[model samples]
Target: MDIRKLDDRLSVAPQITPAEVTEAAALGFRAIICNRPDGEAPGQPTFEEIERAAKAAGLEARLIPVASGGLPPTQAVAEMARALDELPGPVLAFCRSGTRSTILWALAQAGRRPAAQIVAAAREAGYDIAPLAPLLETAA
Candidate 1:
């Protein structure tokens, strides 16, 4: 898993295997947030598999799957925000390439964090967040 830390409490990553969930717990992650919908790819592990692994590792987990290519829906952002508020940190959130997970985090953080700070954080983590500038600005 190519885990990219966005901050002290949250990290975004490309899809992780069930085994990696165990590793994540070992790395001090207290929760897992799955942002990828199952079956988006042919061989990716399902959320249930990850959840089971998380449970076995004594970590909380939640699935707020976002569709592959688009701005996350308002409800999805709301759910993500709730998860961020409630899940024990540090949380590991994953999607196909980590973009969706990052996007959801960015949107959810809007109005709470400055747009520039959010964009800079994602960019520093290797995501090109230029496309989100306008949305991030207005979201605040």
Candidate 2:
């Protein structure tokens, strides 16, 4: 897994396999969040499969799938916030390329920080988050 730290509590990674769950547990990630929609790519493990493996490894897991070209739902953002509040840090999330995952992460953090600061942090991490600016404003 090519994991990139977004902050002290959160990290994003490329799609991971069931085999990586144990390693993630070992690394002290208390929870795993899958941001990729199931069946988006052939041969990708279903969210259930990863969730089962994560649970067996003693880590919490959840699916908050995000569709491309659509704005993230309020429930999705709420669930992420619940995860952040309810689960112990640090948490790890994954998607096909990590862009969607990072976008969701930033959105979930919207009202907690300034939009400019969030965009800057995302940019520093090599993600163009300009499209989310308007959404962040509304969310805030």
Candidate 3:
């Protein structure tokens, strides 16, 4: 698992397998948030498969599939925020390349934190979320 720690409460990564979900739980993650849509790539594990693994490992899982190469919709952002609010801490969120999940997190944090702080957090996590700074400011 190429997990990039974004903070104490959240981490992001590329596509993860069922085995990785268990590993994440073992590593102290309490939940899994999958942002990748099903069938996005050949051999990509379906959300159901990962969900089953999460369940078996006693971790909660939620799917908020964001289309590849596109920004998450407003509803998707809302859902992500809800998950962050409702789910247990130390959540692992993933999508292809982990960009969608990072973007969702950044957008969800817009009003709660300064745009610069959000961008800096994403930068620390190895994602260039500065492009969304304007959008974040609008909400901030």
Q: Per TM-score, what order, best first?
A: 3, 1, 2
State candidate 3's TM-score.
0.98
Rank all candidate structures by their lDDT, best first, as comma-separated numbers.
3, 1, 2
Task: Return the TM-score for candidate 1, rounded to 2 decimals.
Answer: 0.98
What would you estimate as the lDDT of candidate 2? 0.87
Error of 3 at 124 (Å): 0.9
Where is the poorest 10-residue window by lDDT in model 2? 68-77
| lDDT by residue for model 1 (18-137), tens | 999999999999999999999998999999999999999999999999998878899999999999999999999999999999999999988988999999999999998878988988
**Positional deviation of residue 31's Cα in model 2 after best superposition, in angstroms:** 0.4
Model-by-model lDDT, in order? 0.94, 0.87, 0.94
Q: TM-score of predicted model 2?
A: 0.90
Which stretches of candidate 2 lie above 4 Å from their native place? none
What lDDT tens digits, residue by residue, belong to model 3 across residues 1-140? 99998778889999999999989999999999999999999999999999999999999999999897767899999999999999998999999998899999999998999999989989998999998999999998
| Candidate 1 Cα RMSD after full superposition onto the native fold (Å) | 0.7
Off by over 4 Å in 1: none
Error of 3 at 60 (Å): 0.1
Best by lDDT: 3
Poorest 10 consecutive residues by lDDT, candidate 1: 128-137
